[model samples]
Target: MSSYEEIASPADLHADCQAVSHRLQEAAVRATRPAPSIHFDERRREVPKRGIEISEAAQRLANALHLHLD
Candidate 1:
């Protein structure tokens, strides 16, 4: 960090600085995603209306999934 300390104990100061550096390194590692990932049309997330006519194939698929999960 640009903003840091001016303390006495150099050994403890080195340990503290190493701890901070290690934390920053771990944070950098975590802030990444896998190469092959999927994204969707986020706008199409609303629940379907009551009378929306799902196709027979879609209905069968949904029912199969629902039955298995339950």
Candidate 2:
């Protein structure tokens, strides 16, 4: 059997992987935190209105095209 060369020990490799994983987790959490300038409350309030507007537009288009949708 041929012998393999050593790069990093199993323990050392495990520690390095854990450190990298922790850093990635931290970065992901920071990225998802909302921006200061965005008005999330206002946007949430507008959701229903936007849905209604879209529905009205679709209905108007269907009427124009003479498509019978029950």
Candidate 3:
């Protein structure tokens, strides 16, 4: 059964709650850590597409992340 349904008694409910909380905490910690740099030398690589256009939202996100996707 799912976590919300597995709780048979009021006292045992905390165990499920703690499990979910711990999982969320672990996920948060993993997200905060820096990932290894992914090197992609696609400067000269050509795509099948005729042209590409950067979206306004993507530009904003790049600026916010201090990334230069030029």
Candidate 4:
């Protein structure tokens, strides 16, 4: 299947959730220590935001399909 299919799959959605959770956990651990470089901290914050955008897109797609796929 195509990359889009893989990403849109329920299985992959679950994997994305796990991956984001791992990233957040790692960021929390890093935050406990001294602050990293400015660039590093900036990229770190972007990670969760990207995940939220993806999740919102998925939700919107699901809602659209639910309304029109019948």
lDDT of each: 0.74, 0.78, 0.83, 0.73
Expressed as tens digits, the lDDT of each residue in 19-63 for candidate 4 is: 999999999998899865777556655444333234666777878
CA shift of 58, model 1, Å: 45
Candidate 2 vs. true structure, TM-score: 0.45
Candidate 1, which segments miss by more than 4 Å at Cα? 1-6, 35-70
Per-residue lDDT over 7-43 for candidate 2, one digit per residue giving the tens place of the 0 to 100 score: 7889999999999999999999999998776766656
In candidate 3, stretches whose alpha carbon ends up further than 4 angstroms from where it belongs are 1-7, 40-70
> Which residue pairs clash within candidate 2?
none
Candidate 3 per-residue C-alpha lDDT over 1-70 given as tens digits, one digit per residue, 9 for 90 to 100: 6677654786667888899999999999999999865667734467677788999999999989999677
Ordered list by TM-score, greatest first: 2, 3, 4, 1
What's the ranking of the predictions by lDDT, best on top?
3, 2, 1, 4
For model 4, give the 10-residue run with minimal summed lDDT: 45-54
After superposition, which runs of candidate 4 have C-alpha atoms over 4 Å from their true positions? Answer: 1-7, 34-70
RMSD of each: 15.1, 9.6, 13.3, 19.3
Which numbered prediction scores highest in lDDT against the true structure?
A: 3
Q: Residue 20, candidate 1: how far off, in angstroms?
A: 0.5
Give a tens-digit lDDT track for model 1, residues 1-70.
4444555488998999999999999988888745643556644678888876667777788788885322
Give all TM-scores, in the order shown. 0.38, 0.45, 0.42, 0.38
* Residue 42 lDDT in candidate 1: 40
